[model samples]
Target: MNHGHDLNRRDFLKISSLFLAGSAAISSQVGQALSSTNTAFAKDDREEVVHSFCEHCFWRCGIAAHVRNGKIYKITGSEHHPLSNGKLCPRGTGGIGQIYDPDRLAHPIIRERKGGKSSLRKASWDEAITYTAEKLYQIKEKYGPEAIAMLHHGYGYTFFKEMFKAFGVNKFAKPSYDFCCGPRLQGYTMTYGHGTGTPEGIDMMNSKYLLFFGTHYGENMHNTAVQEISEGIRRGLKIVVFDPRFSTLAGKAEKWLPIKPGTDIAMMQALMNVLISEELYDKKFVAENTVGFDELWAEIQHMTPEKAATITDIPADEIREIARTFASYAPAAAVHPGRRTQWYADGTQRVRAIAILNALTGNYKMPGGVVKYEKFKLPKPEAHPHPHFKKDVWSKYPFFVQTKPENSITSHEVVQQTLEKEVRAWFVYGVNVPETITLGRKTAIEAMQKLDFMVAVDTLPMEVTGYADIVLPECTYLERYDDLDGGRPYRTPFVSLRQPVVEPMFDSKPGNEIARMMAEKLELHGVFEDSVETYLDKRLNKVGSSLEEVKKTGVLVGEPTNLYRKPGEKLTFKTPSGKIELASAQLKSAGFDAVPKYIKHPEPPQGYYRILTGRKPMLTFGRTANNRFLNELPTARENEIWVNPRIAQKHALSHGEYVHLKNQAGIVSEFPIKVKVTERIREDSVYMVHGYGHYYKKLKWAYKKGASHNQLISKADIDQSTGAVGFQNNFVTFIKEA
Candidate 1:
């Protein structure tokens, strides 16, 4: 808001260029090291290569693990696989680290009591399973089947979700949707008639323009999308980014707008206004392929660039110019839907605005825009209906309930219910809620303490494990087999295999085996009745392939098809109107605005700044926060708060000086972190990479190393349509150390 800030902006651009070059050099060296084949162990020593999918962070890249004398030696990208294309990101490169980490939970353990001082003792798998089954039955008989709830993640989550349902448990808290990508998926599904599958279907190869709003592909390290965007850049694709901080991708962008946080909708609305006012939209495409265009135009007529400039803090001239550039590019340009759509209460409508922009430019199913790929069908076991429960998504968060058939419960809504003692038991599998969820660590601990019973299943001993009544040690991805990843949005949708490169260490068991064991104990049939390999074989049969062929090739391929929709193909949508709902009658009927309108986000109080968090290339958000190889990378070792130089001076804080942070709720980070005084971030905000400040004492490499952004925020503003927990609305100020 001040002219003096312009000087800081110019300085930031120059400084960021140098920072990126240094970072790139470091990344290249690390990548080369990881990809290099470790030939110290001779191939003749009972060595072999196994094809599997990397579960390091859920990109599901095909990986080849080399085993020597019954031990994994190295991991590399599968050369023939479609997703990786003989390349693996930094996180994927550390696959061996995850599998061989010394701190992994190697045996089942049970806590005698609740609270922090409760002692844990090692137990056999039989004892653990029997205890869990008996307790589950007892709780079900007393409190009803709805008393059991689950919070889980990882590739095997599908089976566990069904297992709970088969056991007649109706409550669940799977957080992937509410915490990460629910709003984005819901918005796209409402507008385009289908959800944009992960590793999005964007055809970046032929695109002329790439528009990003707080989404940085390079930083996120989505393997295929990074490759496509790099190729697009080489072919002269113009990149525009709108973010509060100068992120890794922002350094490479042709145009970077330092947008005010929580104001993306205002900027998008202004773009639509300019396109509609100057007749820059595709008239032919609109008339034939879309519905509700007239209503959208009428609503946007009052939202001029000048009005938007006041809310977004971006120049009016720049807004008009960006709109023109996008229109001229026609269907080749796209507004990329971001993955982390949990920023504000109005997140769903914000994504709807971007969908409207795409519709106006006729980008759906275009060569360089959004495309829909065919999904590989798998056979599901027959399910019997269970009694509906009162405390469910349909009762509490009906507006956000997904229309498409899905079984997992809305996570945030369940967490809220946990506080009120609505559930009696909880099962946590392969997720770290203490470090990753919104609110704060203290709140999570309180909720866990209140549960009648809690069980955790993971390879690593995490904070959640410390609170569990029983802890089941699950084998790592490399030590066991998992379900196939039905490939990406590419023309040829390939299915990749996950086979064990080595046997499970200690007494750990594969997730599927654990699920099957429980199913047998509960007398639940059909699902999990067969071995994981047998199920995979049956599923592959649907696509005219077999487990044998998949193991040989690592991936089974389908025939390629055109990326764009044919001209004569009938345009259809799954919405109420059977067309693109640009004006969104669904929203209007739900007691919400039909069109996205600018709402002023709360500003930080005097002497405080908004806390903003994002991903780093080497760190994958709490999953690998303790990975030794990744932690060794300079950028991923520990997080430093990025503060503007002027703000640093104002607080008498020099670079590398340690300080603690306190939020509006008086919640403080336990550890102190060093300051990074730079001009690459806005003065009103301080930036930190997520996935640090591990409180689990056993995670030696990550414990008390850096400040956790999650711990500093205590507010929860859930999105109306998705129940996404919004933490970006939190404000904090630094506390100087003695």
Candidate 2:
């Protein structure tokens, strides 16, 4: 829903009062009411509108920030943007809450060890930057540039990435790669010869049948994907969901199969077996456009529906019927490659099976199936001179995507190297290290303690900042001009800008300025030779556009390219064999299974259940956890552990009862979690929203609000081929209040 509608003065004041009631540190000017209705505002009241992109989550939807009297009043979706399509998520509207949060990092600080007690003291930006640069240089001199690494998350990390590259620190890791998108990316790249684009190339609006295995669209709240799914539903799209918990998307599905957790590969193999044995697969497509069909069939030939039913708990007859129905839809059906798919050690293979299933149906580039989305082709500006980055591959995984300069290794690998004394210093940008699932909170802290130096750049005093040798407070997205976003792939190719909506509030600076300062401190020249505006304009001018024109609309749109494959067109993939590899030779060469094999994961012990994690629709984990506006809703207040009624009965737990969870490794949850005894989940598993239970006292709103899902991850099952950390192997048991 749009948040840009007109509001009367009384309504605006009421909202402002309620918003400011939570914290005293919020600026009084920020509490000033701005009535969108012309009748409610005085004729002299100054008003301005700034169009930019959002940083609430990775989708980066276009936002129109409403500024009245030099203070941001509201944010709404830009109609010109393809991702948002004039509709914004709740997190986008809550951007004000983040900017006005009381606990935001107001200034730069440096950790000092005085009288043998470590404490964070306020420091000037110069002092903080110089100190951080000197320490990083010292580490580089002693341990070499390979010793320094950067663990980043948000879109603001582009500048710091360049700064690190200039300093000869090529080691970089994005934690989301390790825990969320790594397996899916590597799996699809291996099978299809290209990674799945951001707005995943799903032709949802034209689809007749869509299959989802734990991909909850509604709860994830990716604006464009959710909007397309709604449109697809209106056009008679049928959905089949296989998940342990009945998610928001499951509620919209025609069928919700509560498949056993960690048994997705078995179910997929059964589907393949049904298709091949019954001659339901597209024979023409398999022969003309795919490779390794015989090898794939041989692998799945014995994984019959009856065999999978025993492993997945779905009836054999039901599996066959679903497979037949899916096949009946032909090119109009697809098994969606879900996000955050790193569940078991075989996650890459599980997704590979999904790719094979899609290929078997000839849905590779079909209108109603998987299509390739394109990014806006923006020419890169000339680079500044620097030493060639060290080409050392840190991850031992043979199939790791080492060509990607942004994230060459997994964050867990960085942690391992840090513990091994190979890595000496760290630059953490936007990511909350302990809360983000790298190797778990304990191991993350251990690596942090072991580091010779650590610098954290953030908008708030998150858990990561508490451990930093130097903390540089970055302004919120509302007060920043980040690099142009031409990387997001979409149906209508476009580049979005991130111009400032308001002036920087406190002593905080934008990431671009922070990185530039760090570069100057390190004696790096010509890297940031031009202002951010000049640099942006130069890049935009190459494409016959300017910063002034893009800033007005927030995005520069391009003609929509054809997504679907034409009839009888030969599809040439970028694989080694130049076709879709059903049985990947690259994987085989690396000693991995050429065809996906259903390997049984470890089961929970007696009285324990598998811990499943997801996010709420209104919030985006740590990004919006402390947002007062977003957190005001009852559902957004905190995370609840979803337990099946039978399991609750067995544990003598009641709905709304507070209890702590103890994991298989004997690690207890730091805070108590509310039990939600419902039949919406499987009896063998429990569900909780990720990104909560903040132990950092500075995060007043998010502190100890819910149990931390990452904390219970005492064991990480690493995908050997991709290095994606799988935490679903860890199980938890209830610890009822005494």
Best by lDDT: 2
For model 2, what is the alpha-carbon lDDT of residue 281?
91
In angstroms, the error of model 2 at 278 is 1.2
Summing lDDT over every window of 10 consecutive residues in candidate 1, give the lowest-scoring window.
7-16
TM-scores of all predicted structures:
0.91, 0.95
lDDT of 1 by residue, 252-344 (tens): 899999999999998998999999899999887788767778778777788899998988889999999999999999799998887887787
- Cα lDDT over the full model 1: 0.76
* TM-score of candidate 1 on Cα atoms, chains taken together: 0.91
Residue pairs with backbone atoms closer than 3 Å in model 1 (clashes): none
Pick the TM-score winner: 2
CA lDDT of 352 in candidate 1? 85
Model 2: lDDT of residue 151? 89
Weakest ten-residue segment in model 2 by summed lDDT:
9-18
lDDT string for model 2 (318-419, tens) is 899899999999799999998888887888899899999998998888878999988899987676535766666677888778235457788999999988
Q: Candidate 2, which segments miss by more than 4 Å at Cα? A: 1-25, 28-44
